[model samples]
Target: MNKIDLTITDAFKNKVINPVYLPYLNNETRTQIYFGGSSSGKSYFLAQRAVLDVISGGHNYLIVRKVARTLSKSVFNEITKAIGFLKLTPYFTINKSDLVITCVNGYQILFAGLDDVEKIKSITPAKNVVTDIWIEEATETDYDDIKQLNKRLRGKSLVKKRLILSFNPVYQTHWIYVEYFAGKWEESKNCYSNDDLSILKTTYRDNKFLMPDDIRELENETDPYYKAVYSDGKWGVLGHVIFKNWRTEDLSEKAKPFSMFQNGLDFGYAADPAAPTHNHFDRKNMTLYILDARYCYEMTNDLLAAEIKNMIDRQVITCDCAEPKSIKELRQHGVTAIAAKKGKDSVNFGIQWLQKLQIVIHYTLKEAINEFTVYKWREDKDGNVLPEPIDKNNHIIDSIRYALENEMAIIDRPKRDRPMPKRGAL
Candidate 1:
């Protein structure tokens, strides 16, 4: 330990952390969870807390993520930034190579990814008991990972033994939601603290230091489902969801004979993610089996084509015809991209066609499950619910429509004018 003594006043803490997080500075809860929308400053405040905890002395802290490689730019960097912002740089020895920070007063902060089990086992605090374990991106870690880490806080210490977690709630089925949140969280509330646990929900609105351009970007986002989860910090989807017709199951074991296997693609860029799906159609039973799917942001046409190619073994892919150049690019990249037929009021027809069929999603298809949970009817500017579904956050669903457009047209046509079922897959 260094000879010099260092301290941070209440005024200094108030200056460093957002006002909403001030109350939690000295909170003694065993478990603390801070989750919400993007740019809410929860991680920043907690990062500041990690530094403050170091200055206060008496305990060791562990900062972690699901993947070891991701910590350098995320949780580890956040703490370093916080230490700089709080003007405590000289008092701590930050070992960037090992990602270990030691305070002058004998306490230390360590980082490890849950994937590196041996590294976690080898890391024991030299001075004090490991009093705090901060799991960044807690959503990526499952129950067993947390359970294993939880066992590390066995012995007693001067300070409260704490499990501090931070993340953006992406899906409802995540073990974090089931374990600590489930029925206890409410969309309207921002803070909840009990005798043993503290859960704080925040969003961009809570971040005062955010730039106007960033706020405008979040405001301009049209995807209601993602905005609810990433912008408003809502757990799962929040809206009048369109479908109760979908369920998850392991399709490989119980799959029945299907008429044909098809794939679909929806073009998106900037705020919207490019989505593509592989599915099986059982024409006889009117069931659509979602086999594999993927969504990516900031992906170019070439990358999307390569991704689609990897997902399929040279299957015909129906895609949104609005971007002919992208379709052409896919072809150039060796993807068999076919333009979907366009028709008047096709969105409505396609949605209806899907509503008429039972959609079975494989348990591994997370993106589809989240989209289906939040896809809702479009609302007018006056807030009246319209007859049509919203176009936002339905990239996979839209791709399905595009892939099965001809079939949807069959369902759209008057029954008397409908043609006999084709014997093959689309």
Candidate 2:
């Protein structure tokens, strides 16, 4: 193969830099999400952006995916390709064993997977801490993993902190959607200011580098759902979602106070995640606002109880009826754990009740928002939608159902001042 000129001006002359990403070249927002259809030049532009950032000032970029093992073939290759294309390979030292590129100027570009938390935690840059993070294929990663990555963007750097997420718009319930597109949590108080966020949408039509064959293949796609989400850059409507009636909105703090507050827990096994949600319900309008959520894998009962205690001590926690032993253990630990009433079709019943009400979920409750987005009704072998939901992605939903049982009970009972759950009782 012949040598390719890898100068920034040359790359621009060749139109390798998509004009749509020009706005992102600046440090306007702390968080920027670049989402669009396949072959949209999202990755290439991001890799080029990484290179520019490394060359800009005292900045080191950490590129990430969900799985560490898969980074070398995908994001790693893309970054290196951009580096070589820029013809700046001579200024950088590539360490194959460590997957790091260190520049003579002391800036570095590191790659890691979120799955290996320890590796991510060990990344100490030669200059300052990581100033920028680019998460490719971001939909494959979870909200908590992104939280973990956000912590790394600190420590002695004068560069403006930035987290760039680039992915195809996959599910409507993904936190990326709720935070950027849905505008659900824009008003809810959070650590970061929403004014510092930027979202850019693009598609293959905006990319001049795509081959004619690739463009034809994408244009020929016939599936209505896939075309709508992947090609058109829209939030997916999965088959027949169970919670279609619900929407995400800004729950005004000045509105009527919530009639009730409760906690819900759904335990997990092995790779499955355990989810606990803190909820406040508006009985007059039947709007339930998910205040908070904790989702993790393989958490011990004691640790789970401790986490719940840290959030709200001695609250009435309604858990999965099947986990009575876990509940008893929590009670032993001074938590007010209770069992949700369950009978045949309890899941269906709870879902039906939720459907009748308006659910305004906080963007911080990423677990619940993600579950609500992809939780769809089952489909029969004949391609028909069934009445029941698929078993997957229900950890948070199950917790919500158990917590909503308190709502069901208030239907027949009169309102009374039950003392708030005791704090610091663990």
Candidate 3:
């Protein structure tokens, strides 16, 4: 064995290995995910584990992050620090140009990042045996992209392989978390053990090395609405929604068939484009599906009329509404368009109604989804969820509420009626 590999092994034996990492070391699964809040020693543990694998006669291990910049800034520094602190210089040499470490025993550690889609596609394993693959900040990459990368690690007959992921919880409601970890737990009615393919949770509390002040700071600074998500890893709703129970998948499958289609036009002549959102309402299911979106800048009434005619020809739009001039123009073109009557109160009412329902959305309308995810309630001085003025960046959601309010008017009727109060003697 090379002197550096020996030294690295000794360091892992003495200073690096901790009880917290034992579960991972003992886990038999080929895939593992370690996710939690910030500053929980996840990265450090991952690096140390990879080094141990290399020193133990492993020939093909890779340490990767989201991008080259992050590898250079964070992961690179952590590995170097471990190498230096462990006094492993004599046993191995770091090839700076190729970003690899080679030990005397022929084991190799390659460092790379998977930020660009093309770069990820171009990656080919040096040997048929890729023993280890580590991804830091795994959430930044698309879930489907990660799945594709996992398929590339097929090994030869003699090779054994493993994949590790580390991420801080950010989007709890995101598809990846919801489908894999949360869904699994909900089905099994138990926390994921080391035997499971997924490890859905970890927290700063699990790490003994964090300073008290740091923990206190995170606890104090995080807003109440977001504290459970960021600190405790709980799932909850975010921002304004027409249907709180509604998700993108619901709209595609259950609500599409019953839709009564219409269009909502927000008009602008020169400064901003005339933007129209095509909507389909399924009255039977009490769901609204936003089918398509179109915007054209600085168009004359003649051109706008042609566009409206094309849309009508495609499907029967029961009604359409726009601003006063746009409405008059549509009438002149022999299409019946009226100005929609809705005040702030009515708009808010629609949004509230939508929030109460379970709805699904199509993924292609990412802009609308983004708007919904970031829409938040106003918070008080003490960082509490409060009913008050709306938060910022809610224009898209507002537009959606406007369209739905005009078309759908289904309200939740009470199941039981309260007896009228008995009249007292005047």
TM-scores, each model vs. reference: 0.71, 0.56, 0.56
Look at candidate 2 and tell me the lDDT of residue 207.
Answer: 88
User: Cα RMSDs of all predictions?
Assistant: 6.7, 11.4, 11.3
- Candidates 2 and 3 compared by TM-score, better number: 3
Q: Model 1 — which ten-residue stretch has the worst lDDT?
A: 417-426
Error of 2 at 60 (Å): 0.3
Off by over 4 Å in 1: 1-5, 26-30, 36-39, 51-83, 88-163, 167-177, 182-190, 194-196, 203-238, 256-259, 269-271, 381-383, 409-426
Deviation (Å) of 235 in candidate 1: 5.2
Where model 2 places Cα greater than 4 Å from the true spot, the runs are 1-7, 10-14, 184-194, 241-426
Q: What order do you get sorting by lDDT, best first?
A: 1, 2, 3
Candidate 2, residues 100-186, lDDT tens digits: the string is 988777788999888788988988877778888989889877778888888887777777889888888877656667766675433
Task: Identify the leading candidate in terms of lDDT.
Answer: 1
**Which tens-of-lDDT digit does each residue in 1-426 have in candidate 3?**
432324334445545554566566545477787776666677777776666556556446777765554466577677666666555666667777667776666677777776456765565544435667777777656566568768766756244566777777554566657656764655222136554375746556666767999789667744554565556544444633223354565345644465366666556544344555666766666766766544444567777667666654444322224457667866687654556666445544555567655555666554456456656655656555454425433444555554565454444323113231122210
lDDT of 1 by residue, 103-150 (tens): 888889999987689999778887868999989988767678788888
Error of 3 at 34 (Å): 0.5
Q: What TM-score would candidate 2 get against the native? A: 0.56
Q: Which parts of model 3 are misplaced by more than 4 Å?
A: 1-14, 95-98, 124-128, 157-159, 186-191, 194-200, 235-371, 381-426
Worst 10 residues of 2 by lDDT: 417-426
Residue 178 deviation, candidate 1, in Å?
4.0
